[model samples]
Target: MATLLHIDSSALPQGSASRDVTAVFRKTWEEQHPEGTVVYRDLAANPLPHISATALSVGSVDPAEFTAEQRAAHDLRVELAEELERADAVLIGTPMYNFTIPSSLKAWLDQVIIMGRTAGEKPSAAGTPVTVVASRGGSYAPGTPRESFEFVTTYLEKVLTGMLGLEVDFIVPELTLAATVPAMAELVGKSEASRAKADEEAVTKAKALVARLAG
Candidate 1:
């Protein structure tokens, strides 16, 4: 059975837009692949530390001559790398904060996107596959005025597709309800309707992709 890594980076519990959308995707994914296993990681609740200077320097020195700090860092990186390599699929819930991916999410990325492990220097190869489910509270799709202001989606696509060589898939639900006050009121009034619509759309796309993957 395939394993799916579900990563949630939002600090907000029930009210987080990213988590809310991710939940929808996860439910749909589980329904489609009842035999698949899921490993959930809540970065907000249990945050990962930033890479230390010791961690980087450890690679320069021989492992036999490494200090305690260097060994600890190496162990952490190894553990993180193993989790990523073992998973068949990854589902990341990311929100735009200050027009970029969340710091917690970035930290998680640092742990997983390791050199000579998750990616790097493989001659003959079929690349890995990764899917990201991004949620934001603004209209930033192409042709929209705020599209250029979006760094989150573009950066992720470049890193995952261009750098890591993963077949990247993304679901971006435009949360336009928060665009204006009256709209916000209406959104609160019919939040379930909005969520349901977004969920339906995401589920349809995700299921199709999964079927292709299984085939």
Candidate 2:
């Protein structure tokens, strides 16, 4: 049976744009693969420890020579990597935070991105498709003044594709704060439209992805 690794990192548990879209995608996926497995991780609720010297250094040393602390750290890293490697697909929901991904997601990346394993020439999870629901408070697409400041999709595309060799696709819901943020109040209509489109894409993409995998 297929397995999907679903991860959510939005700090806002409620009314999270990315989370909403990801939920739609996952629901569609579940409908298609009723017997499939889903491994879910709520990064904000249970944040992973950031990479430490011991964890990073353990990769370079011989496993037989690892100290007690280093061995423990290495084991955690191995577990995370193995979980990723076994996935048929991945789903990540992340709201743009400070123009980038949240610290929780970054910490998970650091822990899972070990050289010669998940990040090397022959990445263990290579060719796995990862769909990212990248929601943002404001428009930052090309031609926007803040385009250069947009880092969430660009960074993730590089890390998930370039480094990890995963196939990355994005469903962006921009201007997510229009309904609540005073500065973006005028864009409420646009935000709603964006969210609607994202939801539509989530369903379409999820169905198409499942079909492609089944093929």
Candidate 3:
């Protein structure tokens, strides 16, 4: 059975487009792989601390020389890396904040990006499939005025694919705030269309992943 590492970093508990889309994907994954296991992490609920100088040196420094705080930080990083390393696939629900991913999600990514474990030579998570549900409050697609401000998916693609060598797929729902923001009322139809497409892609891709990995 396949194991999935599911992570959500939306600070908003409700009305989060990324969370909603990822839930659809997760449900489809469960239906297709009933015996599969999912290791869930809510980064909003339990945010990881930013990597400190000591934490950054954990891989190179001898464990025997670690201070109490450093050891604790190192342990958390190890756990995060192991979770990713063991998963057959990864799912991340990230909402754009200030034109990029929420800091909560970035913290989680920092934790799992172990030097020797996920990067460097002989990387353990090199070939894992990572599905990212990236939701934006406003339109940032090509041709949109805010397209240049879109750093969420672009940054993630660079890190997850270029750095760690993961196969990353994106399901983007744009103009998420249009549903409730009066100023964006004119874009509501387009927003709904984007969400619908994201939903459909989530289900289709989830099923395809299951078939490819679990079959």
Top-lDDT structure, candidate number: 2
Model-by-model lDDT, in order? 0.73, 0.94, 0.91
Which RMSD does model 3 reach against the true structure?
1.1
The TM-scores, one per candidate, come to 0.85, 0.97, 0.97
True lDDT of residue 208, candidate 2: 90
Assess candidate 3 and give its TM-score to the true structure.
0.97
Evaluation by TM-score, superior candidate among 1 and 2: 2
Candidate 2 residues 30-127, lDDT tens each?
A: 99999889999999999999989898778788999989999999999998999999999999999999999999999999999988889989999999
Model 3 over residues 1-215: C-alpha lDDT tens digits? 89999999999899889999999999999999999999999999888898788778777878898889889988998898889889999999999999898888888778778766788776788999999999998988899788899999999999998778899999999889997999999999999999999999999999999999956
**Candidate 1, residues 1-215: lDDT per residue as tens digits?**
76777889877776777787778778888888889888999999999888767776666789899888888888887777776667677788887887788899888777666666566764111155566767777667789788888988899998776645667777665563463456566555344555566678668866875686688
Q: How many Å off is the CA of 180 in candidate 3?
A: 1.2
